[model samples]
Structures are given as C-alpha cells and as structure tokens.
Target: MTSAYWPLADLRIRSGPLELRPPVPAEYEVLADAAAREPHAHPRIPFLEHTADTPLRRGRRTLQWLWSDQGTWRPDQWSLTLAVFDQGQLVGVQNVRAAEFARTREVRTGVWVFQDRRGQGIGAHSRRALLHLIFDGLGARRAQYRAAASNQASLALARSLGYAEDLAPLTADDTVRHFSLTADCWRTRTDPVSTHVTGLAPALFMFGIGHE
Candidate 1:
C-alpha cells in the first residue's frame, strides 16, 4: 500500500538484532507514545525544547516532527527517519539526512533509543546501518555528525565508529563538536559490527540516486 506510492516505506536496514525502517501510518501514534514515555531532556542534546513541557506536548511534538519530515521530502534535500525496532518492538529512531547529496555526497545522522535500551549497543548498530546506507547503498563520499560538547555518549559513539573530529570552529555558542568519516575510512575501519541494507534498489530514486 504505502510502497505503491512511497517506495521509501519499503526500505529497511538490519544490523544485528536491530531493524530500521520508515514508520508506517499505524506506527505514527506508537512513535509518539514512545516519545512521551521517554522524554530526551539532556540540556546539551538538541531535542525539541517543548517536549519537556508535558507528556501530551511531547507526543504532539514528536508527531509534528515526523510528519514534517515526511511531507517535506525531496531528492535535493531530505531526511530519512527510521524507527528502530528490536524483535518487532519499537525501541527508538535513527535519522540520516543530506542536502544536495547528489553533488555534495555527504550525509549527517542522529539517533535516539529508549532509556531502557541504552548501553546495549543499540546506538552503535543503528549508526552502522545508516553508514552502510550512506556509503554503500547511496555511494556517499563522507558522513558527518554533530553533538553538543557535553554529550559524551554521542561523541563517544562517533569516535568508536572511526569518525575523526572536525577541526572547524564551532558556532558562536561553542557548544557543539563536529566529526566526519570519509567513505575510504569507513571501508577500512575495523569494527566487529556489520550491517545489511535491503530494498534499497527500489528506493534509491527517492534519494535522487541512480538518475546519473
């Protein structure tokens, strides 16, 4: 049904016990419920500020954010937000996005897992899947990441996945750190984790790939 109109709905990425896919209409409320249950409120981590106002607000914000991405998708600029599921249970979400990716060949990513699921290497596996999609499935040249300087977990994840810190100056706030991983580096990085992307061939056109 969804794949008949939006092929992206058919895309999936699997790494270990994790599965990443675009949330279907039925799962929209489920995603909002997850956000309400687990409000990510780290001051440094960039989350919707209004989410902490109330549980109802949190859920509303989550739905709005997801819908915005879905409605605004385009080949030149788009965000692919994948719901993370472990054994068919929704755990969290991982997002990979790019601007003019066909020419720039770069992408950025972010992830959020339920509090209970943290420290179980879910974040690492989710990222590996996105990297595979970026570099292998989409033929990206480099991948980028950004996190608040105080967000140790995010920075650690990037470093552990073989990303090098970017030397560029931070914004006026000087609160975020940037990192990058070239495709060559991703290919040679010795990480025990491996990922597989499926249904990508049918969705490549959605990402503006295979046109050239």
Candidate 2:
C-alpha cells in the first residue's frame, strides 16, 4: 500500500478488552498527558531518554516518536509502536520491533501505562496483545525485554510472562536487566488474552510473514 493510504492504520490487534493500533490523534494526546503527569523519581528515567516535565515537551516527544517510527519502517528493520486502549480510552503504549526480522525472526517489546492506570493489569494485557501480534500475526520466533532494576514493574511483568533472564549489557547501569522468550517458552504463560488480528493479510509481505 502507498503512504497516502497508510495501510498500517488498518492494522489492529485485540485481546480481551485491550486493543493495539497505530497511534492516531486521540491516542497520542493520552500518551502526552500520561508522560507529563506520570512521575518517575529515579535519576535513570524509565524510558530510553524521554522526559515528562511538561505537556508541550511530552507532546512533542511523543509526536516525534510516532511520526518517525511510522516513516521509517522496512522489512529488515522496523519500530511499530501501537497505542494501547482500554474500553475505548487510551491507557498506554506497547511496542513490537526488530532488525533483520526475516533471518532472525525476533522481536522486542516495551510497554508503558499511565501512572494512574498502573496495578490494574493494563500493562500485562497490553504486552500480551503485542506478543500475540509478534508471534501470531508477524510469525516471530523470539521476543525480548530489557528493563533497569529500578523498573520493577517491567521486570515483574516479564517474569510473569515466562521470559527468561538473559545476559546482555542493557545499558551503562548495572541495575538494568534483560530477558528473552523463544516461541516454545512463550507458550507457557497461557494467558486468557484471546487475540484477534485483522488487516494483516495484505501486510504480510512487509513483515516477512508467510510468502515474504
């Protein structure tokens, strides 16, 4: 499909009450609000290098991230950041991305929920939806996760999903941790998040799924 059509916009993955889709105006606004209001006291920010100090800053950063990733997708490497919505309201962001996916058949995941929405199982359901997309929709063989120790929530979620601790220099900080799951390892979690992926048949070639 052409960029004019933005075929990715048709893509949607749903699990239980959660849905993951490319960011639109409404979802982007929620992310900015969450970033600004969600406080992180640690010196090491939870995200790569994002700040939620102000609404304008958060808005710019989120917009930049969404547009840049959308513009740069390729079969060999890509970043697909989906907006996570709960009951039609934006709650967080979930990502499934990788490089040389055709040969490696791997993808990595990262998730973030609004500060006020935490502990309500949004993170878990969102990531499970991503895994469903990666492995089921995109045919990925492996999925990965890395989080700093200070990000206890992320680490805990990884463990709960049967991700195995892995040896990797995640960052300059030693507190950072890494984890991975093979397709086999992935089957263990067995969460009841029944997945539904649509708008994928036409996009299979781009993701190297099936005939690609």
Best model number under TM-score: 1
Q: How much does candidate 2 score in TM-score?
A: 0.87
lDDT per residue (tens digit) for residues 1-212 in model 1: 35566888778888778788998878989877876776556443234444337767777878888898889999999988899998888988888889998889999888888778889888887888888888889999998888778888888998999999988745655678888999999999765666888878877777888742
Note the clash tally of each candidate: 0, 0
RMSD of 1: 2.1
TM-score of 1: 0.91
Model 1 lDDT at residue 40:
57
Q: Model 2 over residues 1-212: C-alpha lDDT tens digits?
A: 23435667788888888888888765666676666665553222333255325556655666677777878888778888888889888888887888989899988877878777899999888888888778777778899888778778878989888888876554566777878988877766676857999977767667655553
Q: What is the lDDT of candidate 2?
A: 0.76
> How much is 182 displaced in model 1, in angstroms?
1.0
- After superposing all C-alphas onto the true structure, candidate 2 shows an RMSD in angstroms of 2.9
How high is the lDDT of residue 26 in model 1?
Answer: 86
Give each prediction's root-mean-square deviation over alpha carbons: 2.1, 2.9
Look at candidate 1 and tell me the lDDT of residue 180. Answer: 92
Compute each candidate's TM-score over C-alphas. 0.91, 0.87
Worst 10 residues of 1 by lDDT: 43-52
